[model samples]
Target: MTTRPLPEAAFRVLLSLIFLVSGATHLLRPEAVAARLDGAPFAHVATALAPSTSLVLLAGVALLAGGLALLVGYRTRAAALGLIAVLVPITLTVQLAPEALGPLFKNVAILGGLVFFAAHGSEGYSADRALRLRRARRLVPALS
Candidate 1:
Protein backbone atom coordinates (compact mmCIF):
# COMPACT_ATOMS: atom_id res chain seq x y z
CA MET A 1 0.00 0.00 0.00
CA THR A 2 2.83 2.40 -0.73
CA THR A 3 0.76 4.09 -3.46
CA ARG A 4 3.40 3.32 -6.06
CA PRO A 5 1.94 3.36 -9.54
CA LEU A 6 2.13 1.36 -12.78
CA PRO A 7 4.78 -1.24 -12.02
CA GLU A 8 2.80 -3.47 -9.69
CA ALA A 9 -0.37 -2.88 -11.64
CA ALA A 10 1.33 -4.00 -14.84
CA PHE A 11 2.82 -6.99 -13.10
CA ARG A 12 -0.54 -8.13 -11.78
CA VAL A 13 -2.17 -7.91 -15.18
CA LEU A 14 0.65 -9.70 -16.94
CA LEU A 15 0.79 -12.45 -14.37
CA SER A 16 -2.97 -12.89 -14.54
CA LEU A 17 -3.02 -13.57 -18.27
CA ILE A 18 -1.77 -17.13 -18.05
CA PHE A 19 -4.23 -18.02 -15.33
CA LEU A 20 -7.09 -16.37 -17.20
CA VAL A 21 -6.34 -18.27 -20.37
CA SER A 22 -5.69 -21.56 -18.69
CA GLY A 23 -8.79 -21.26 -16.53
CA ALA A 24 -10.93 -20.69 -19.58
CA THR A 25 -9.43 -23.76 -21.13
CA HIS A 26 -10.09 -25.80 -18.03
CA LEU A 27 -13.70 -24.72 -17.83
CA LEU A 28 -14.26 -25.10 -21.53
CA ARG A 29 -12.53 -28.49 -21.75
CA PRO A 30 -12.09 -30.07 -18.36
CA GLU A 31 -12.11 -33.53 -19.88
CA ALA A 32 -9.07 -32.60 -21.92
CA VAL A 33 -7.17 -31.42 -18.86
CA ALA A 34 -8.13 -34.62 -17.09
CA ALA A 35 -6.94 -36.64 -20.07
CA ARG A 36 -3.61 -34.86 -19.99
CA LEU A 37 -3.16 -36.13 -16.46
CA ASP A 38 -3.45 -39.76 -17.53
CA GLY A 39 0.29 -40.41 -17.64
CA ALA A 40 1.42 -37.87 -15.09
CA PRO A 41 3.69 -39.20 -12.38
CA PHE A 42 1.44 -37.82 -9.70
CA ALA A 43 -1.72 -38.83 -11.46
CA HIS A 44 -2.38 -41.46 -8.84
CA VAL A 45 -2.04 -38.89 -6.10
CA ALA A 46 -4.65 -36.68 -7.74
CA THR A 47 -7.09 -39.45 -8.63
CA ALA A 48 -6.84 -40.98 -5.22
CA LEU A 49 -8.23 -37.79 -3.74
CA ALA A 50 -10.91 -37.02 -6.36
CA PRO A 51 -11.97 -37.62 -9.90
CA SER A 52 -9.66 -35.96 -12.41
CA THR A 53 -12.42 -34.01 -14.18
CA SER A 54 -13.89 -32.74 -10.92
CA LEU A 55 -10.51 -31.48 -9.76
CA VAL A 56 -9.87 -29.89 -13.11
CA LEU A 57 -13.15 -28.00 -12.95
CA LEU A 58 -12.51 -26.89 -9.40
CA ALA A 59 -9.09 -25.62 -10.33
CA GLY A 60 -10.64 -23.87 -13.27
CA VAL A 61 -13.14 -22.03 -11.07
CA ALA A 62 -10.42 -21.02 -8.63
CA LEU A 63 -8.21 -19.79 -11.44
CA LEU A 64 -10.91 -17.78 -13.14
CA ALA A 65 -12.21 -16.24 -9.91
CA GLY A 66 -8.75 -15.47 -8.59
CA GLY A 67 -7.50 -14.21 -11.92
CA LEU A 68 -10.37 -11.75 -12.22
CA ALA A 69 -9.87 -10.48 -8.70
CA LEU A 70 -6.15 -10.11 -9.23
CA LEU A 71 -6.67 -8.32 -12.53
CA VAL A 72 -8.71 -5.62 -10.78
CA GLY A 73 -6.43 -5.57 -7.72
CA TYR A 74 -9.41 -6.24 -5.51
CA ARG A 75 -8.49 -8.23 -2.43
CA THR A 76 -5.27 -8.83 -4.30
CA ARG A 77 -3.36 -10.57 -1.54
CA ALA A 78 -6.15 -13.06 -0.99
CA ALA A 79 -6.60 -13.56 -4.69
CA ALA A 80 -2.93 -14.26 -5.14
CA LEU A 81 -2.97 -16.74 -2.28
CA GLY A 82 -6.00 -18.48 -3.78
CA LEU A 83 -4.27 -18.80 -7.13
CA ILE A 84 -1.18 -20.18 -5.43
CA ALA A 85 -3.35 -22.80 -3.79
CA VAL A 86 -4.59 -23.91 -7.18
CA LEU A 87 -1.18 -23.68 -8.84
CA VAL A 88 0.75 -25.84 -6.37
CA PRO A 89 -1.36 -28.95 -6.81
CA ILE A 90 -1.61 -28.50 -10.56
CA THR A 91 2.13 -28.08 -10.97
CA LEU A 92 2.94 -31.03 -8.76
CA THR A 93 0.46 -33.30 -10.49
CA VAL A 94 0.83 -32.17 -14.07
CA GLN A 95 4.16 -30.42 -14.61
CA LEU A 96 6.58 -32.39 -12.51
CA ALA A 97 7.75 -34.67 -15.26
CA PRO A 98 11.09 -35.34 -16.94
CA GLU A 99 9.67 -34.11 -20.22
CA ALA A 100 8.03 -31.09 -18.59
CA LEU A 101 11.09 -29.32 -17.26
CA GLY A 102 10.12 -26.14 -19.06
CA PRO A 103 6.58 -26.10 -17.70
CA LEU A 104 7.80 -26.93 -14.21
CA PHE A 105 10.15 -23.98 -14.29
CA LYS A 106 7.40 -21.78 -15.67
CA ASN A 107 5.16 -22.69 -12.73
CA VAL A 108 7.97 -21.80 -10.35
CA ALA A 109 8.21 -18.37 -11.91
CA ILE A 110 4.45 -17.90 -11.60
CA LEU A 111 4.67 -18.96 -7.96
CA GLY A 112 7.28 -16.29 -7.38
CA GLY A 113 5.00 -13.65 -8.84
CA LEU A 114 2.02 -14.78 -6.74
CA VAL A 115 4.16 -14.79 -3.61
CA PHE A 116 5.15 -11.18 -4.18
CA PHE A 117 1.56 -10.01 -4.47
CA ALA A 118 0.45 -12.10 -1.53
CA ALA A 119 3.10 -10.53 0.67
CA HIS A 120 2.88 -6.91 -0.47
CA GLY A 121 -0.69 -6.57 -1.76
CA SER A 122 -1.61 -4.03 -4.42
CA GLU A 123 -1.50 -0.22 -4.59
CA GLY A 124 -2.32 2.75 -6.83
CA TYR A 125 -5.26 2.62 -9.23
CA SER A 126 -6.61 -0.43 -7.47
CA ALA A 127 -9.86 -1.30 -5.73
CA ASP A 128 -7.96 -2.11 -2.53
CA ARG A 129 -6.34 1.32 -2.53
CA ALA A 130 -9.54 3.13 -3.36
CA LEU A 131 -11.48 1.34 -0.66
CA ARG A 132 -8.73 1.95 1.89
CA LEU A 133 -8.70 5.61 1.06
CA ARG A 134 -12.44 5.82 1.36
CA ARG A 135 -12.38 4.11 4.74
CA ALA A 136 -9.64 6.47 5.91
CA ARG A 137 -11.70 9.45 4.84
CA ARG A 138 -14.69 8.20 6.83
CA LEU A 139 -12.62 7.49 9.94
CA VAL A 140 -10.76 10.81 9.96
CA PRO A 141 -13.96 12.85 9.81
CA ALA A 142 -15.72 10.79 12.50
CA LEU A 143 -12.78 11.14 14.93
CA SER A 144 -12.82 14.93 14.60
Candidate 2:
Protein backbone atom coordinates (compact mmCIF):
# COMPACT_ATOMS: atom_id res chain seq x y z
CA MET A 1 0.00 0.00 0.00
CA THR A 2 1.12 3.53 -0.72
CA THR A 3 1.82 5.79 2.25
CA ARG A 4 0.03 9.11 2.53
CA PRO A 5 2.05 12.28 2.79
CA LEU A 6 2.07 14.08 6.11
CA PRO A 7 0.30 17.43 6.29
CA GLU A 8 2.51 20.50 6.48
CA ALA A 9 1.16 21.58 9.85
CA ALA A 10 1.73 18.13 11.34
CA PHE A 11 5.26 18.01 9.99
CA ARG A 12 6.01 21.47 11.35
CA VAL A 13 4.73 20.53 14.78
CA LEU A 14 6.84 17.36 14.83
CA LEU A 15 9.95 19.27 13.83
CA SER A 16 9.30 22.01 16.40
CA LEU A 17 8.88 19.38 19.11
CA ILE A 18 12.45 18.22 18.58
CA PHE A 19 13.76 21.68 19.42
CA LEU A 20 11.33 22.11 22.29
CA VAL A 21 12.54 19.01 24.09
CA SER A 22 16.18 19.69 23.32
CA GLY A 23 15.90 23.27 24.57
CA ALA A 24 14.22 22.18 27.77
CA THR A 25 16.91 19.58 28.36
CA HIS A 26 19.64 22.17 27.87
CA LEU A 27 17.99 24.51 30.34
CA LEU A 28 17.37 21.80 32.91
CA ARG A 29 20.74 20.10 32.69
CA PRO A 30 23.19 22.82 31.81
CA GLU A 31 26.08 21.11 33.53
CA ALA A 32 25.69 17.88 31.58
CA VAL A 33 25.48 19.76 28.33
CA ALA A 34 28.38 22.01 29.28
CA ALA A 35 30.42 18.94 30.04
CA ARG A 36 29.77 17.63 26.56
CA LEU A 37 31.00 20.90 25.08
CA ASP A 38 33.97 21.04 27.44
CA GLY A 39 36.58 21.01 24.67
CA ALA A 40 34.46 22.61 22.02
CA PRO A 41 34.76 26.20 20.77
CA PHE A 42 31.39 27.03 22.27
CA ALA A 43 32.82 26.25 25.70
CA HIS A 44 35.10 29.26 25.34
CA VAL A 45 32.10 31.47 24.75
CA ALA A 46 30.37 29.94 27.75
CA THR A 47 33.42 30.51 29.91
CA ALA A 48 33.39 34.21 29.02
CA LEU A 49 29.99 34.57 30.68
CA ALA A 50 30.02 35.52 34.35
CA PRO A 51 28.47 32.16 35.27
CA SER A 52 29.53 29.25 33.09
CA THR A 53 25.92 28.18 32.72
CA SER A 54 24.75 31.58 31.51
CA LEU A 55 25.68 31.04 27.89
CA VAL A 56 24.11 27.61 27.87
CA LEU A 57 20.94 29.05 29.32
CA LEU A 58 20.94 31.80 26.73
CA ALA A 59 21.24 29.29 23.94
CA GLY A 60 18.44 27.24 25.47
CA VAL A 61 16.17 30.26 25.64
CA ALA A 62 16.86 31.12 22.02
CA LEU A 63 16.06 27.57 20.99
CA LEU A 64 12.89 27.55 23.05
CA ALA A 65 11.69 30.83 21.57
CA GLY A 66 12.44 29.71 18.04
CA GLY A 67 10.66 26.40 18.63
CA LEU A 68 7.61 28.17 20.00
CA ALA A 69 7.50 30.49 17.01
CA LEU A 70 7.75 27.56 14.64
CA LEU A 71 5.07 25.63 16.51
CA VAL A 72 2.62 28.50 16.06
CA GLY A 73 3.75 29.41 12.56
CA TYR A 74 4.59 32.93 13.66
CA ARG A 75 7.58 34.41 11.86
CA THR A 76 8.38 30.83 10.87
CA ARG A 77 11.19 31.68 8.47
CA ALA A 78 12.96 33.70 11.12
CA ALA A 79 12.54 30.89 13.64
CA ALA A 80 13.97 28.36 11.22
CA LEU A 81 16.91 30.64 10.47
CA GLY A 82 17.61 31.03 14.19
CA LEU A 83 17.65 27.24 14.61
CA ILE A 84 20.04 26.89 11.70
CA ALA A 85 22.38 29.42 13.30
CA VAL A 86 22.47 27.42 16.52
CA LEU A 87 22.71 24.04 14.79
CA VAL A 88 25.64 24.94 12.55
CA PRO A 89 28.05 25.68 15.38
CA ILE A 90 26.75 22.80 17.45
CA THR A 91 27.21 20.30 14.63
CA LEU A 92 30.74 21.50 13.93
CA THR A 93 31.92 21.80 17.51
CA VAL A 94 30.06 19.02 19.32
CA GLN A 95 28.91 16.39 16.89
CA LEU A 96 31.81 16.20 14.46
CA ALA A 97 33.94 13.47 15.97
CA PRO A 98 35.26 10.09 14.75
CA GLU A 99 32.92 8.17 17.06
CA ALA A 100 30.03 10.59 16.66
CA LEU A 101 29.20 9.96 13.05
CA GLY A 102 25.56 9.12 13.75
CA PRO A 103 24.92 12.31 15.68
CA LEU A 104 26.77 14.39 13.11
CA PHE A 105 24.68 12.99 10.28
CA LYS A 106 21.48 13.48 12.23
CA ASN A 107 22.38 17.11 12.85
CA VAL A 108 23.10 17.59 9.16
CA ALA A 109 19.67 16.23 8.29
CA ILE A 110 18.02 18.48 10.86
CA LEU A 111 19.88 21.44 9.40
CA GLY A 112 18.53 20.57 6.00
CA GLY A 113 14.99 20.55 7.36
CA LEU A 114 15.47 23.90 9.06
CA VAL A 115 16.81 25.39 5.84
CA PHE A 116 13.78 24.10 3.95
CA PHE A 117 11.46 25.62 6.51
CA ALA A 118 13.30 28.94 6.37
CA ALA A 119 12.97 29.06 2.59
CA HIS A 120 9.29 28.12 2.60
CA GLY A 121 6.64 29.64 4.85
CA SER A 122 4.52 27.33 6.99
CA GLU A 123 1.83 25.97 4.70
CA GLY A 124 -1.27 25.79 6.91
CA TYR A 125 -2.72 25.72 10.46
CA SER A 126 -0.42 28.50 11.63
CA ALA A 127 -0.58 31.94 13.22
CA ASP A 128 0.73 33.44 10.00
CA ARG A 129 -2.26 32.02 8.15
CA ALA A 130 -4.60 33.29 10.84
CA LEU A 131 -3.15 36.77 10.63
CA ARG A 132 -3.46 36.74 6.87
CA LEU A 133 -7.07 35.62 7.15
CA ARG A 134 -7.81 38.42 9.59
CA ARG A 135 -6.29 40.98 7.27
CA ALA A 136 -8.24 39.62 4.34
CA ARG A 137 -11.47 39.84 6.28
CA ARG A 138 -10.79 43.46 7.19
CA LEU A 139 -10.01 44.34 3.60
CA VAL A 140 -13.18 42.74 2.22
CA PRO A 141 -16.33 44.41 3.56
CA ALA A 142 -19.04 42.02 4.87
CA LEU A 143 -21.93 41.40 2.50
CA SER A 144 -25.05 43.07 3.90
Candidate 3:
Protein backbone atom coordinates (compact mmCIF):
# COMPACT_ATOMS: atom_id res chain seq x y z
CA MET A 1 0.00 0.00 0.00
CA THR A 2 1.30 3.38 -0.92
CA THR A 3 0.95 6.29 1.46
CA ARG A 4 0.23 9.43 -0.47
CA PRO A 5 2.01 12.59 0.59
CA LEU A 6 -0.14 15.09 2.47
CA PRO A 7 -1.56 18.10 0.64
CA GLU A 8 0.22 20.39 3.00
CA ALA A 9 1.14 22.84 0.27
CA ALA A 10 -2.48 23.14 -0.76
CA PHE A 11 -3.41 23.82 2.84
CA ARG A 12 -0.89 26.61 3.03
CA VAL A 13 -2.17 28.07 -0.21
CA LEU A 14 -5.71 28.10 1.15
CA LEU A 15 -4.63 29.68 4.41
CA SER A 16 -2.52 32.26 2.64
CA LEU A 17 -5.27 33.19 0.20
CA ILE A 18 -7.70 33.70 3.07
CA PHE A 19 -5.33 35.98 4.95
CA LEU A 20 -4.21 37.86 1.82
CA VAL A 21 -7.78 38.64 0.84
CA SER A 22 -8.78 39.70 4.34
CA GLY A 23 -5.70 41.87 4.80
CA ALA A 24 -6.19 43.49 1.42
CA THR A 25 -9.82 44.19 2.23
CA HIS A 26 -8.92 45.91 5.47
CA LEU A 27 -5.95 47.78 4.09
CA LEU A 28 -7.77 48.97 0.99
CA ARG A 29 -10.66 50.42 2.97
CA PRO A 30 -9.28 51.39 6.30
CA GLU A 31 -11.84 54.14 6.77
CA ALA A 32 -14.70 51.78 6.24
CA VAL A 33 -13.27 49.33 8.70
CA ALA A 34 -12.27 52.08 11.07
CA ALA A 35 -15.77 53.49 10.96
CA ARG A 36 -17.18 50.12 11.87
CA LEU A 37 -14.56 49.84 14.55
CA ASP A 38 -15.10 53.18 16.23
CA GLY A 39 -18.35 52.29 17.96
CA ALA A 40 -17.76 48.60 18.44
CA PRO A 41 -17.86 47.18 21.92
CA PHE A 42 -14.31 46.15 21.20
CA ALA A 43 -13.24 49.58 19.97
CA HIS A 44 -10.96 50.34 22.86
CA VAL A 45 -9.41 46.93 22.49
CA ALA A 46 -9.08 47.38 18.75
CA THR A 47 -7.31 50.66 19.30
CA ALA A 48 -4.81 48.92 21.53
CA LEU A 49 -4.78 45.66 19.56
CA ALA A 50 -4.13 47.14 16.12
CA PRO A 51 -3.11 50.67 17.13
CA SER A 52 -3.62 52.60 13.83
CA THR A 53 -3.74 52.51 10.08
CA SER A 54 0.05 52.27 10.05
CA LEU A 55 -0.13 49.11 12.08
CA VAL A 56 -2.91 47.97 9.81
CA LEU A 57 -0.61 48.60 6.84
CA LEU A 58 2.14 46.61 8.44
CA ALA A 59 -0.32 43.85 9.19
CA GLY A 60 -1.33 43.94 5.56
CA VAL A 61 2.26 43.58 4.45
CA ALA A 62 2.83 40.76 6.87
CA LEU A 63 -0.33 38.99 5.75
CA LEU A 64 0.54 39.38 2.08
CA ALA A 65 4.11 38.22 2.54
CA GLY A 66 3.17 35.42 4.90
CA GLY A 67 0.40 34.24 2.64
CA LEU A 68 2.63 34.25 -0.41
CA ALA A 69 5.31 32.44 1.50
CA LEU A 70 2.85 29.80 2.63
CA LEU A 71 1.29 29.38 -0.78
CA VAL A 72 4.69 28.92 -2.40
CA GLY A 73 5.71 26.46 0.30
CA TYR A 74 8.72 28.61 1.04
CA ARG A 75 9.38 28.85 4.74
CA THR A 76 5.79 27.78 5.24
CA ARG A 77 6.13 26.91 8.90
CA ALA A 78 7.60 30.29 9.71
CA ALA A 79 4.92 32.05 7.70
CA ALA A 80 2.14 30.10 9.36
CA LEU A 81 3.52 30.86 12.78
CA GLY A 82 3.90 34.51 11.92
CA LEU A 83 0.29 34.66 10.80
CA ILE A 84 -0.77 33.07 14.09
CA ALA A 85 1.11 35.71 16.00
CA VAL A 86 -0.79 38.40 14.15
CA LEU A 87 -4.09 36.61 14.44
CA VAL A 88 -4.23 35.41 18.07
CA PRO A 89 -4.45 38.82 19.65
CA ILE A 90 -6.99 40.14 17.18
CA THR A 91 -9.01 36.98 17.54
CA LEU A 92 -9.15 37.36 21.28
CA THR A 93 -9.53 41.12 21.65
CA VAL A 94 -11.70 41.96 18.65
CA GLN A 95 -13.40 38.91 17.19
CA LEU A 96 -14.39 37.39 20.48
CA ALA A 97 -16.71 40.21 21.44
CA PRO A 98 -20.15 39.06 22.60
CA GLU A 99 -21.92 41.00 19.89
CA ALA A 100 -19.62 39.77 17.13
CA LEU A 101 -19.96 36.01 17.24
CA GLY A 102 -20.22 35.79 13.48
CA PRO A 103 -16.87 37.48 13.02
CA LEU A 104 -15.57 35.39 15.87
CA PHE A 105 -16.40 32.23 13.96
CA LYS A 106 -14.41 33.46 10.99
CA ASN A 107 -11.45 34.25 13.18
CA VAL A 108 -11.64 30.84 14.82
CA ALA A 109 -11.66 29.16 11.45
CA ILE A 110 -8.55 31.05 10.38
CA LEU A 111 -6.93 30.33 13.70
CA GLY A 112 -7.55 26.62 13.23
CA GLY A 113 -5.95 26.75 9.81
CA LEU A 114 -2.96 28.69 11.10
CA VAL A 115 -2.39 26.19 13.88
CA PHE A 116 -2.56 23.29 11.47
CA PHE A 117 -0.22 24.91 8.98
CA ALA A 118 2.23 25.80 11.70
CA ALA A 119 2.45 22.17 12.79
CA HIS A 120 2.61 20.70 9.30
CA GLY A 121 3.98 22.61 6.37
CA SER A 122 3.93 21.84 2.65
CA GLU A 123 5.03 18.24 2.41
CA GLY A 124 4.02 17.67 -1.20
CA TYR A 125 4.92 19.71 -4.28
CA SER A 126 6.76 22.30 -2.26
CA ALA A 127 9.76 24.56 -2.68
CA ASP A 128 11.35 22.36 -0.08
CA ARG A 129 10.80 19.41 -2.37
CA ALA A 130 12.51 21.22 -5.23
CA LEU A 131 15.43 22.06 -3.01
CA ARG A 132 15.68 18.47 -1.91
CA LEU A 133 15.60 17.30 -5.52
CA ARG A 134 18.36 19.70 -6.46
CA ARG A 135 20.50 18.61 -3.55
CA ALA A 136 19.97 14.95 -4.45
CA ARG A 137 20.97 15.64 -8.05
CA ARG A 138 24.19 17.26 -6.90
CA LEU A 139 25.06 14.30 -4.66
CA VAL A 140 24.73 11.68 -7.44
CA PRO A 141 28.07 10.46 -8.82
CA ALA A 142 28.67 10.98 -12.54
CA LEU A 143 30.25 8.06 -14.42
CA SER A 144 32.28 9.12 -17.44
**Best candidate according to TM-score:** 1
Q: Per-residue alpha-carbon lDDT of model 3 for 36-143, expressed as tens digits?
A: 656566567757755556556776788778877777877767988998987876666567667789988988888888887677665677786688788878878553
lDDT of 1 by residue, 74-119 (tens): 9999999999999998899999989999999999999999999999
What lDDT score goes with residue 29 in model 2? Answer: 98
List the lowest-lDDT window of 10 residues for candidate 3: 1-10
TM-score against native, each model: 0.95, 0.84, 0.79
Candidate 3, pairs of clashing residues: none
Pairs clashing in candidate 2? none
* Candidate 2 wrongly placed segments (more than 4 Å): 1-6, 39-52, 142-144
1 or 2: which has the higher lDDT?
A: 1
What lDDT does model 3 reach? 0.73
User: Each prediction's Cα lDDT score?
Assistant: 0.91, 0.80, 0.73
What local lDDT score does residue 117 receive in model 1, on the 0 to 100 scale? 91
